[model samples]
Target: MAWVVAGVVCVLYFAGTARPGYLLVRDFVTVPDPVLGAAALGRDGAAPRAVPLDAITAVLDPVVPAALQQRLLLVGSVLLLGAGVGMLVRSRGWPAVVTATVVATWNPYVVERLLLGQAPTLLGVAALPWLVIACRPGPYRSQLARALLAALPAALTPFGSVLAVATLALVTTATSGARRAAAVALPSLILCVPWVVPALAGAPTRSAAQGADAFAARQDSGLGLVGSVLTWGGIWAPGAHLSSRAEVVPMLAALALVLVVAASAILAVRGGGRRAAALVLAWSVPPVLVLALATPVGLSVMEVLQQVPGLALFRDTHRLLGVSVVGGAVLAGLLVARTTRSLSPPAVTAAVALIVSVVVTTVPDGPRRLHAAYTPVAFPSEWADAVSSVPAESRHVLVLPWQAIRPPLPGGRVPFLDPVPRALEPPTVTSRDLVVRRADGPVLVPEGEPEIRLDDPTQARRALDSRQIDVVWWWGVPESEPPPGFVTVHDGSQITVWRRGGDPRSQLPRGILRPSTD
Candidate 1:
């Protein structure tokens, strides 16, 4: 059953595969930056993000044939998910387990989420069933497998780890022994050390612990919130999606599935007072809280909650929808098993297969369009040459465009992609700052991330000196030449590089920091 669903999902994923071109949209950028490594380890920023996926990406590096990278991840993830769901319903026999597998793998929302590049969160989703298994009364061998299963998602993100832990707590497990809890938790901690230690250090991303705007549901109303969960719209991040087009059929499908899940869980809980059924319903709390935050009262409550560290890790509330989907599938499986028990084996098989086919086929072809967005770009030789020319000790070059700021974007201020920050090597500081234009003028405010505004030569140089910037790499041809004492090293069609006093590491008098009023 798992194999059948896994094969179908893999085919669906690869259907969109294209080389050198697969890298399209913000989600697909393959920039080379090492600061993320530092950030992941909790060394630099006050609010550093968890980057388990980034670590895997770094390991895959230039060796893994850049074009195939996302494909590999996409395929591996869906297969693991299919298998995990299959194992969860394995005791249910043919029709029930098969139906659950289809429900889990027939993930239309997952396509949109993947397009938005929620890879780390998706890994948590895939790890869910295994996390549930770890909570069940089981032998040491099965418990060991549970530990390993718990580790994958735990290593991915804080959100995933919390879900894993919460599930162990919420579900009415027969096993009360601390041994089972210990088995699940111990490996999770060991596996997630790279992220856990840094996050524990009390660093926060600039936007960390911020607000409901970043954390709440994209859709405000209860129905809209429910629909968003059905269609996987919670992340509210930038990505091309069919739901954005108001496609009626998909919207209706989402609403229907939500009903099916709700009804199934209700029936299961009422019928036998099942712990698993209750657990799935409990999973809805996070998304529900996000929806509640749409109101002024809820926003006030969330602000108070923000005082606790790691609480906002799930700010992009859509990440938690994976658990809800899993719960729906589990309950749906139970309903199928009970209602169809009277049918002959062959008849049940045909009926369930037909149902699975209809559900999968009707799903919007969002991933296919996403696959069309694939566009792989080779790293420019000019940037490579510039990096090589710098003195060995030189660290964190500041680019000419000081930071990525924008005119207007739906999610927030994102710089135009001409010279994205990720293109530079580690120790390089580019900007991820939020910028806004005041009604009165052309000035841009530094809203979130730390940024240095160097709109002119002297100010730019002073900003450089204050921070002890090593190299200044500019891609655009500014009307004015660089400041005095700066020696031009390489001026080519792609970029112009300058070394101050023949060294990117040169020092000048200590100066005031770049004024915010600039």
Candidate 2:
């Protein structure tokens, strides 16, 4: 049974992730576990928020090939999604199994996110159902196994962790054996300490600075955003929007989608699955409320919430939408569970046909669409040239074009990404870059990498002297010149590398520090 479900998941997802593209999106950039303890930290910015999978990645960092490290998560994603929904309809017939798998796996919420390279968010998506299962009554053979499952999402993504706790809380309040649940949940907190301790210490991260709108649920009307999210297609990028207004078919499909959810919730309660039904309902509703408030009427309320320290963490409604997909799928699973009892040919045929029709409507030409959108890339030879110039033993390195920002994907024009300090593979240099998000950020660490403004070259020079940055690779943007008295060691079409010195510049151009446009 397990193998069959796994096989189906692979076949479905491979159409999206395999060959022509895999890990091709920007999300793969954050897979390096940048927050792992090191002698020098990245001044490039606060590391993407830490979660439990980071610790796992960190442990594997030394031995595993870098490409394989992230690929492991990519592979786990489909398995978890398959296994999670499988858990929800395990006893039901093959129609329930096939229908549940397709309904859960083929959604835009999953594929579009994969194209955007949001591995962690998808990891959370895959783990979400299992988290609920581990917390509620189950057939687990051991107490320790359940407890570990309870903590599983906690380790995957921050939002997933909270959602897990929320589900557990709802289940705990209604169950008779509250003591056992409490005891199980308490130790799971211990397991979360790796991520929890760092977060509680208030170690600065890029996440802390995000304004509410940057993380807002949607740019369109609240109701419209709710519709888009429901139909599996609300995204920050404009092109990704699957607008209902664009056509009549989409409008009817979305409306029908809503009716399906409402009907499934009603059916679950009537079908001796009240607790499960309530769990999905509890999970699904908040995303709409959040999107609504983020829109206008409740803007004032969100304003206050944004100000509260640590509250902005929930600001990203897109992440919430991804997490909510499971609830909707489980509800759909319940509806199918009602019909697939006899495993009759007609029942199986209907279920399979329905799932296929939805997939086609939502994601026409899936593999071809993916191929056009997600062509993979490799690091340019220039990156290799620059890293080689930096002495292997250098204590720290800083990068310029340091906005401490998340920019749109530059259309794959560059081989890798911005700020080599953050994305350098076969990472060699130690970095203590400050994580401040201000656009005109005042130089924080002085010389090395903390948003250095050339106007304050004294402080910049002092910052340079104090930290002694080896091989300052200012590559992504054009600059007028290398700072005074810095020896030019390596200059290339994409970057200018410099080491502190008392003498004049090298044979490279004395002024106008720009890389070749080509």
Best by TM-score: 1
Which candidate should be chosen as best, given lDDT against the real structure? 1
lDDT (C-alpha) at residue 121 in model 1: 60
Candidate 2 minimal-lDDT segment of 10 residues: 509-518
Reference-based TM-score of each model? 0.78, 0.76
TM-score of 2: 0.76
Candidate 1, residues 1-518: lDDT per residue as tens digits?
77777677667665645444334334333444322344334443323344555555556665774346656666666777777777887788767677777777676556656655555566667777776666676676676566566646555666666666556544313454565566555554555565556555552432423454544555421335556655445455333344432556555555665666677777776776556546556446545755667556876766565555545444455566677667767766766777778898788877776656545643557546545543244445566666555554555556555444312122222123222333343334445432322223333323233334344457556665664565667664444465455666777666666666643433332331232221
In order, candidate lDDTs are 0.55, 0.53
Q: How many residue pairs clash (N, CA or C atoms closer than 3 angstroms) in each of the candidate models, in the order given? A: 12, 7
> What is the TM-score (0 to 1) of candidate 1?
0.78
Q: Give the per-residue lDDT digits (tens) of candidate 2, residues 1-518.
A: 53366566556555433542224344455333232433113222233243555545555667874456666676577667767776777777555666566656666567666655565667767776676566665543465476476457445656666656655555554552566666555655555454444444443432322344444555322346666666656655343333433455545654565566668777666666557656566546756666675676566665566544345445556766655566776666666677655667886788657754664455544444444444444444576666667765565555554433233333342122343443343232322332322224322321122233322335445556554554566654345555655667777876677775654432222333212110
Worst 10 residues of 1 by lDDT: 406-415
